[model samples]
Target: MCTKFYDSEFSFLISTTEIGNSQIIYEEFWFYTEFVNIFFQNTTLQEKEKERKIENVIKERKEIVIKERKEEKERTERKEKEGNGKERTERREKENLVLYKFLLEQLMNQRQKRNTPNNPRKNKIKRNENFAQKENEGSSSEEESNQFETQFQELVDSLMDSNSITRCEKYAELNHNISHYYLPIIGDFFDDTLLAVKNSLKKGSVEEQVLAIRCLLLFSITLEDAADEIFNQFEPLLLKYSLEGQNKLKIASIEALGILSYFITNTGDLDSSQKILRHCISILKNNFIPQNGGHEIYIAKVLNMCSLLLSLQANDFIGIELSGNNESDGGIFFEYIVNIGKSFLEYPDLDVRISSGRLITLAFNLKDRLEREEVVDSDIDVDAIVEIFNKLMKEYSQKVSKKTKTKQRAEFKQYISSIEECIYPKDLITIKSNKIHLEEWPKIIQLNIIRNFLGSGFQKHIEKNFLFSQLFGYRIKVESHRQKHYNKKSQRKEQKKNKKYRQQNITKERKKKNNFENQFM
Candidate 1:
């Protein structure tokens, strides 16, 4: 009989043919169940593998997005930093520009105020006659002088400002441009300006004192006479600062004293110059000892001052005895300088060595001058100096190696060349078209010192300043084309006037001769 059977696990209907044949049907059903189970299991495993693959791809995508966000954030931060830096730089530039403009405007205002007419009668005078022209020119020059004095007074007043930065700026401006204002300031306003500077020197801070010292030196250059009372008044203070003050003040005071001594010598005050030289020598002797060797710069400055003073006053010291009993010998100072130079040649500091080399060169120059002057009986020993320099040259040449600094090597070569030049003197021609030939070491040193003092104004002074022209023995008669034309026109007018005067004299003589002949007839 046929029967319907249900398999719950497989959910399939089965028919039983017979009880005996049920075993085979059951076996077949079991096989189908196992196959279905295996198939379902395989499908489930495949679906799980697909799901795992999808999850891995999603995770990779998230990671990529996260990395991209991080990169974008970093880029934005970098851009912001660059933008901030640019902003800061721009702001500084803008501030500087503003300050520059303000200063320019202030200067313009000062100029306008100075240029404004002060005297109506002077302005009303017709500039037709030569006398009037001369008067106008003189008035204009006086007005310019007044203008400069006013501007200088304003600068000095500004230096007294409460703001240190403002004071510094004004001081720098005045110092840098002192050449322009020095002549005017030295006129009627000299006393007031001097007082202001002296006050600053006495009462102001270290920076102010330094600035005042520089200003004083610049003013000292404008002094026409060597025996100016200012020298006596300021000498003690300057000496005090040079000996007692520290750092920049001491250096400035020393340089000021050197320049003062130079001016004193220039003015032919050998007594004062010699005194200054002695003072400098005494300082050097005290400072050059091993105990004070740590102050190389100070020692160098003192050496430089001695060299400058000696080079300038070498002639005076050569043949003349010291005035007082303090020093008996005449040429002993020269020997002292030579000894100092010899001792300092082995100094490690470049400045000290250079200074010593200059001192030695000056000593040799002094000896050469003495020989040229036919003063053959001097105490200076030239052979010993030559031997020392030769040794120095050999030592320097041997010390040059790959490890040597480029600056040091170049300086050494230059120093050696300068020494050789001292031995065999050569003319050092300046670079200007109107060449200044410095044939002597003293002249070279003087020019160097003046150049350092005048800075940018050196060229201007060399061209137009009478003092510099005389000092360098350079006649700079720089006439512009317009000036030449005017001169030629004036010369022609003078020639025409002379011709008319000659013609009139000749006509009068002829008339007188005719009258005499008629009377004789």
Candidate 2:
């Protein structure tokens, strides 16, 4: 009886309690079975099949949302671009309308003036009779003109509310007081440019200062008359700006000084021209690079302007009479090159690098080696070459004596040698050779590269290249020589035609006479 009871109790414990090793195994197995049943029953579909369907839904929703956001962003951008473009076009149209209305009013007033007589008729009745009618007539036109002006002003006010920059589009007609239509306006404009440039130095927006200085530069290029005051007044302002003005204004002053110096030797005002050149060269010694983000572009351009100014001055001084006073100014040439050399070596820009290199190659061939050698101590060196090369290549940089790179200095030596060794100077100095002298022609090839990099700023390149006489000289030589050839060919062709016509006339006369003789026989 005891044995039977013990066996039954052991079986009951195994069935009900589940202890030790058996408990773990049973707990795992039971938990797995429960998990499998719960997972399958709670899910409405098979696990793998349901997972794929859910995942597809989530991915499609996510993709749709992402695409919507992208499309929304693109729409906003498109609207913004279109809005800006429309605003600009409207502003330009408004400016043209205002300028047109102003000119029309001024002309109408002038016409009324030209018809007026110095002496009035001596009859009081006649005067009183027409006074009311004339007044009404004048008032009607004046009211109409005033209405147009008011509309223009309202448009301008609306535009001004949005944009702070001066909204000067192309002017249909200059303001009545501007005096631009008269070619002889320089005599007056010289004074106006002088004042505007002076005031710009004192107080003006950066753009205003630039425009004012540019106008002064324009005035300095005198074709109608040689005004001493143009250069004379221009110099003091340039010197002041060179010494104390901010970066942008100072650069404008430098460019104006250089442009003023361009070809001024033809006007017999070499002294003042030299003075402008000398002051402009002063910028190279103590240049202003704006402490903002655009340091490379600004300083590079300033240096470029300074270099071109130096070249212009040197061109003037070439074959010119040099005295002790002129010798004092000679040191700046070396400094000018050195400053540009530093920009080439140190500037982190592709355009500046390429520009400085091309300018260096151009200096390669100046006839004055002794002068270049003296400055080579300071201006030409390896620092510049590496600086320039760094802009060109990411992996490689030039390694050489910091002092001896004198890239331009060495180039000057090589150019002088090549020109000196050549048996024919004219052959060595044709447009073709100059085009490839440095493998970086500014126009034929460099412009294309620059255009690819900088779009509308190519106008600046054009302005920069135009400042060089060689460019203009090259164009003029080709045009004028081609014109001469054309004229000669046209003359020869005309002569041949005339000769043929003469022979035909003689044949016709002979035929007529032969007919007469045959009739008489």
Report lDDT per candidate.
0.67, 0.47
- Write one digit per residue (lDDT tens) for candidate 2, span 340-442: 5555544555445544554554343332443555533333554545444443433234653433345434433433333344221121123323542322222
Best by lDDT: 1
Candidate 2 stretches with Cα past 4 Å from truth are 1-201, 219-228, 287-294, 313-343, 368-521
**lDDT value, candidate 2, whole model:** 0.47
Q: Which candidate is the best by TM-score?
A: 1
Give the worst 10-residue stretch by lDDT in candidate 2.
Answer: 168-177
TM-score of candidate 1 against the unseen true structure: 0.59
lDDT score for candidate 1 against the true structure = 0.67
Q: Estimate each model's TM-score.
A: 0.59, 0.40
